[model samples]
Target: MIPAASALARAGHEVLVACVPQLVEEFTSAGLKAVAALPDQAECWAEITDTGHDQVIKVVVGQRLLARGYPELRKVAAWFEPDLVLRDGMEFCGCLVAEQLGIPHVAAPSGAVNTLAPAAIAPLLNERRAEFGLDVQDDPLAIYRYGRIDSLPPRYSFAARGIPRAVAYRQPEASDRCEPLPSWITELDPGKPLVYGAIGVALPTAAASRDGGKASTIPADPVRALAALVGALSELDCTAVVSTGGVSFPRAGVPPHVRLVEHIAQPLLLQTVQLFVTHGGYNSVREAVRAGVPMVVAPLFGDQLDNARKVAELGLGEQATAPSEIAAACRKVLGSSENLARARHAQRELLALPPVDEVARRLALLASAR
Candidate 1:
């Protein structure tokens, strides 16, 4: 979330960022204040069919993005008279425009709202909050009643299996603004073991956001899944790299210890890698648990199969899909030292949270105590 919207615009607050037109210049080049309130990304991922992720996120992605993004986010929250609306976890019209104007709505981090199931999407968002006349919620976490926002911490959470509990923060190892790592990544091999890979950029930017036309319900062909993620990181002996966010593949049988690139800077190359190879996207498993690395997951769908089953149920790695199980789950998480100490104990529980500029001054005194 652009490092908590650049720490709530460096604590002065007033951050906008509604989003959709394939990310309005990634939130106006990360200076914040953005719009395109919704639509385009092949019409907001054509309600991601092939159904059944809590019945396609409660009967089709909260009624197709609340009937195409609730009238420009309720005319941009009734002309920005906002205190809090902060939606992100598959944004359902910023909690019905903060309950049609009562305010305070949180929920930023998302692996589809941390593996769905708030009584299976709260009786379909309480039937769209009683057709937006509000006053409905029987609390399957009344759209999180101001308690959501996480960057993984609950013993390496992917969140749902019973939810409500997120105020964790601190996952910003990189991308408060990206693009830097490619000076031929200092010519690879510091004697092998580097790996990286990336089958993301969310289904080829939602199947090439119809800037071309037709073909969208993203049935995955992301250039043949980036040619089976550069043919399983060219048979991994290490020294990889990958990215391919700019998708294109098949360099005949890619070798020379792989390289690929369509973009890199992945949490600054997972802090000098040693095995990642993801698809288990929940912001790439909270950027490989803020770079303690260790994955090999090959999930290719929403909540990336519950973040590859919480990275092999918290051993921090291993889950594969074909390409010889992604080169044997990248040589079983590069010959596990107990999955590299459970990925450095989920990077010390993502460095014991808090710091996102102290959760943006405790969410601006929780929207100025409403």
Candidate 2:
């Protein structure tokens, strides 16, 4: 997402990124000034690891840190005086700072937030709003102070809550949109049955362990499960495009037909592929739906399970708890007329909507207008 911001900066905008300290170097490399914030990555990690009898302990620590750092955040915002303060939703300080500075701010959600009348955090949100000298409102929907900027369809949240669909944003063919795949995979025979497999971005490399133990050839046991899914695809004579993701495949033992690469550009692959097997991350599901590719999701943790539920409920995809079931699910989707028909219909609906860039532009426009 910072990369997207960098692209915008390249288009002749003055952009100052407010992020934790560790990300400063990477942001600097991309030619943006960085504003380091309180509760840096290490502290956040400590909070994550701070588990014991009292679950509220972490929250207590977080509140203390945030309270201490609010002044620093205000100082930074005053220094930058940005035309628009685009923020990740999780950063409450940014919102407060933006409000205090009387600057137009936009909520660039990293993932889905509670779209309802603030039921998920009504008490907390209300209290925070009061602290910021905002009015209390009965309508939960009115709580969204800054307009939302998201890649997801508005239907994604509205339909989940039984509301009528609002027209969503669309992206035009901007040169800055995700480019075509590198020439190598672009030439693959699009006619063949392509099965694209992926885990997500956050997982550790299978080779690197925290304990510094012998780095196994396969970094994590999850690969074994992923490999099992591949074997199942081979059983059905499907061409498997397995993304090993920085983990080397055993040279002598790889299947003859499966092509193993570290990564295949996802948006491009989705265009030509018949099936997508993925970890059900929000980005993967959104991309697959945007491309209209039916998915077989293997959820690991967090909102992935919820995402998988949405896929299955919408008839856009199927889910597998164990890796062994992936192949059978693939075959089911491939062989069943009902599954194929449902998937195609879902794809058609998704593709007709606008692209993500247009969505961001609309959000920025709406936020600035407010």
| Candidate topping lDDT | 1
Give lDDT per model, in order. 0.77, 0.60
The TM-score, computed over Cα atoms with residue i paired to residue i, of candidate 1 is 0.33
Q: How many backbone overlaps does candidate 1 show? A: 0
Clashing pairs in 1: none
Q: Point to the candidate with the largest TM-score.
A: 2
Candidate 1's C-alpha runs over 4 A off are: 1-41, 44-67, 71-86, 89-92, 101-104, 110-148, 152-166, 169-191, 203-205, 208-238, 241-248, 259-282, 294-346, 351-370
Give each model a TM-score: 0.33, 0.73
Q: Residues 237-314, candidate 2, lDDT per residue (tens digit)? A: 666677766554563566655677776677777777788888777777767766778888877654566667777777
Residue 322, candidate 1: Cα error in Å is 32
